[model samples]
Target: MTGTELVIDGVTLTAGAHCLVEDVSLTARPGEVIGLVGPNGSGKSSLLRAVYRALRPATGRVGVDGADAWSLPVRQLARTVAAVVQESGAEFDLSVREVVAMGRTPHKRLLDGDTAEDAELIRSALAVVDATDLAHRSFDRLSGGERQRVLIARALVQQPSLLVLDEPTNHLDIRHQLDVLGTLRRLSATVLVALHDLNLAAYYCDRLYVMRDGKVTASGPPAEVLTPHLLARVYGVASEVIVHPRTGAPQVTFLPGAPALATRVEADPSAS
Candidate 1:
């Protein structure tokens, strides 16, 4: 599937009279993976909510392919943007396959049945997510990690031009987290994902958007954006920046309570 360019221009979000995010602007270029990262309650999720129309902006625009996103009908929008959110709740006892099949809803009519191609897509998604064995199990019985994998599989089956995910690696083991992110890196769809792990954001994302107190504090290539000074200023944590010898990505090493002592200890062999 081809990717769509996503632009959030001067977007401001609010809850009643309280502003959640202020004048945030960013972009996910076609076929690129952009990472959103900030401390909890920094308004990363709020901004994503506006992009997917779960919440409307007070003043600004969210556009896909250079057209206004909020102007499109829900079904039309769903067909182009697929999302996997952290709060994906369901009380029903649908089978895993059934849960994944729901992603195809936007492409089908009210009376249309699942075609062979649809079944194949479902199976392929399951396989890619390593959930093929759980396809017959009840979705409600799965663990949080299992449910996450299934939900991402569902998103993949939708095959949309843009993918928006919030904390997609929440509750995942290290291996599964890497696997899921690796899959995203290979996909053609433009991805706009919020992540809590700075290391993963650096390793997986093509670029990084650092948010702080409802503003775009920093944004650029991962190496350029993830600096010690910026991290200290925005995250309030002293860190040392290093380059990964293998991948050449920026790797952040946060200092402990005492920054000066931590540096000396790191340099001293006896501290190990």
Candidate 2:
């Protein structure tokens, strides 16, 4: 409710004759977190790529803050939309502070020096991701979780109205996963994240978009879209959907395909 709004209209992405995403249209409201979930090869990444301009839709339009995103200058777009992508290799071995400072590139003129304000913004971003302590560390030497946080800090330094993240929790431990998602939830910017963790998606997302094959299979609040029937039909998995005891959020527990007898193994008294 405090950042930019996204309006994707009739968006379609295709690779040669194969359609990746088709006729996908959705609005992401300011200060709202929307989760995109699907099985592998279901176009969740493809849809997000279109939103961030990594992949231009073969047809349709993506509008951010009421203007066509494609119509904006690339630099202007970069300033408005910050993305945390899956790519994490930095061959140049930049320091953490330097990597974060890169986020301010869009706001500065070519060959411009870093102003005091820019440095302050970088510090602030680092603080947001709790990475300030590692500011002087080599980015390449950090663990995967540390690197992920630094990248997020970099995106935060951009001060964009819209934030897009793809599998942001990858390689994170449970605690770090919660920390990262919690940080995203607290940001004022609009967020659209692709997640494979259904429980995390339900816990953090204000709305959900469930994709299958190459189209949106369901879109709504988590409680509405994450029902057992939908899970079975879309994911080919039988699941029990329940509300979280604390947050009252929809939680899913999948039932494996094997028979119940195989799933049940009584504890052995001798082993105990």
Candidate 3:
């Protein structure tokens, strides 16, 4: 099956009397990368949870490929949208390959045995994330970045139309960060990623959604949404927006406040 398109229409997620997300609506088209950006408590994770069906909306609807997301069977949804979340704890002693193979579960019968084709897919997915070298390694023994790559490979093996990733670059070093995002950019599937790094978001995302206090404050192409004013207002940090020399993407540099600026300039006369 082809990858799916995701649409959130007037969705509201409430917990007790508090609305964690309010009337949030967005569409992720096939083959597009949409970055979700917000402060720590700004509902970025909550909204993503709704997309992955971790939390159902209190009002409105989420649709996948023109069908209501809730109406799809759990197994079917698993095949359509694969996610890599922030939490990566697994209490099992499964090997990296075994963990990635679990992505094939939705495609198999209850007691179905793994086929040669399943093994091939698993290998291919591992290669995509550069985890093939660690295939036989125990997941628990791997470093945080390694484990994250394994989880991403598992998601890739699911062959979903839409991929949702939460802070995929969190534990990765600079090179791995670029490598992972670069891989996502080359994939055909639609991607909705929650990102804290505005520079990385600008580098990989086709468009961006800026959330503030559980509401979507602005959304558009990275160049348009990542303006100085928007960053200052939403993130409470003054930033300078510049165009990337090679890619023409928006590059953001946070402006240090008075104290840090004085220290830096005083330390080096040419720094300013």
Candidate 4:
């Protein structure tokens, strides 16, 4: 399947009585990569959850291929969208291959078994991430970085038209981070990924949305959004936005000072 557009319109996500993210609207064009960037407790993850339908929006709609995500059946939605989340359940004792194979579940009919095609797709996914040799390893036993790559492979096998990932580079080293982002660059899917690395987001994403205090303060191409003034206003930091010599994307280098956020060390987890 080819890529399809993803739209989150007038979305408000809440946790308990607190509004985590309010009235956010964004779009990921077909086969385009969009970045979500913000400080911790800025509601990046909360907004992503609503896109994948793991969390329902308090008000607004998430549209995939011009259809309402909330109106679609869960199974149908899964087939169209796949997600790689931070801190997936820790108790599963499955092997790397088993975890990857689960990506096919959305496609299988009830009481049906895996087809030979499914096996090939699973193997292909592992190869794409260079995790083919680790197929027999216990998933729970892998290092955090290894587990991240495996989870990405699982999403790859899903063959989704729209892929949602929350901090997909969480545990990766610099090399793996580049490798993984390169992989996303080659995929024929609409991608909305939450990233803490501003440089990487600028390098990989076609457009970006900067969230601040549960709202999007800016959204545009990296060049327009990564200005020093915006950084100071939203991230409460001092930085210089420079043109990358190679990619021409915006690069931010921190100045010698602490950010100005009040209560930087600890924030209400519910707001995030």
- The lowest-lDDT stretch of 10 consecutive residues in candidate 4 is 260-269
lDDT of 3 by residue, 109-203 (tens): 99898899999999988988888899999999999999999999998888888999999998999988998999899889999999999989988
Tell me how candidate 3 scores on lDDT.
0.87
The C-alpha lDDT values of all candidates are: 0.90, 0.87, 0.87, 0.89
When sorted by lDDT, best at the front, the candidate numbers are 1, 4, 2, 3
TM per candidate: 0.94, 0.91, 0.92, 0.93
The number of the candidate with the highest lDDT is 1
Stretches of candidate 1 off by over 4 Å are 258-272
In candidate 4, stretches whose alpha carbon ends up further than 4 angstroms from where it belongs are 258-272
In model 4, pairs of residues that clash are none
Which has the better TM-score: candidate 2, or candidate 3? 3
lDDT of 4 by residue, 1-272 (tens): 56889988999998899999999999999999999999999999999899888889999999998999989998898998999999585755999999999999999988788899999999999988888899999999998989999999999989999999999999899988998999998899989999999999999999999999899999999989988778888977877776766666777777767544222122233543
Sliding window of 10 residues with minimal summed lDDT for model 2: 258-267
List of clashing residue pairs for candidate 3: 3-161, 4-161
For candidate 4, what is the lDDT?
0.89
Q: What does candidate 2's lDDT look like per residue over 93-195, in tens digits? A: 8899999999999999999989999989889888877789999999988998889989988888888899999999998889879988998899899999999
Give the best candidate by TM-score. 1
